[model samples]
Target: MVLDPSRYQDHRTWKMTPGLLRARQPYFRNNMIGLAILAGVTAGIYSYTYRFLHKDNDFADVPIPPIDEKELEQLKKEYEQHKNERQ
Candidate 1:
């Protein structure tokens, strides 16, 4: 069951074998890996943006609407009358 050590002795020479010369030469860059990295970055940025925008609740800077107290009272009376008529 002993294996020959001579077969694997020339490890560097295996890359220069004549028939497999094409495999030894460097090839073009892979687009899928680059695209996957870009997608991951974009998703991370979008997630951060969503979290940033939704994190605030107390919007104190915005101006409140000028509501008239008399008009609100009249509206309430009208609503009550409408409800009574309906019943």
Candidate 2:
């Protein structure tokens, strides 16, 4: 019998046919295709986010001043004093 040419490219139609599904049992056995598809989608989304963050310059507009060392030392001493009192 002549093979149906369309079945070669069409996944849904090809799976429905007895010959293809039965013949290729090893391809669909333990959810291999599903997991591969999920992994590919995750990788694509991660790459897209990385490119967007690196290319954007929105953070440049926000000025960040240097932290005051003296004030930070005072806060740390206060925190330690409070912990000591609690204990």
Candidate 3:
């Protein structure tokens, strides 16, 4: 049987129809809201993490103890003794 072009006249191309757009409007709106919330939460978490990581230390003004030569020699002797025992 031969197909007739006139019989297919009612069918249109796959362009967006008004009814389809209307049906998907709520879904699109919800997705956009969810995306906005996700973006806001991500930004907040990043900002908080950056601030936590880079904040000024409370102990920055404390002075470090000077190294003692007597303590260094004692530690070296202890380390050598320990190494010999381990071997």
Best by TM-score: 3
Candidate 2 or 3, higher TM-score? 3
Q: Which pairs of residues collide in model 2?
A: none
User: In terms of lDDT, which candidate is strongest?
Assistant: 3
TM-score sort, best first: 3, 1, 2
Q: Candidate 2 residues 6-85, lDDT tens each? A: 66345555445666667678767557878988999999999999999899997789988877999889989999999999
The best-first sequence of candidates by lDDT reads 3, 2, 1
Q: Give the CA lDDT, 0 to 100, for residue 24 in model 1.
A: 39
What TM-score fits each model? 0.38, 0.34, 0.45
Q: Rate the local accuracy (lDDT) of all candidates.
A: 0.73, 0.80, 0.82
* Residue lDDT tens for model 3, 14-58: 355666677788899889999999999999999999999899698
Better of 2 and 3 by lDDT: 3
**Residue pairs with backbone overlap in model 3:** none
Residue 56 of model 3 has an lDDT of 68
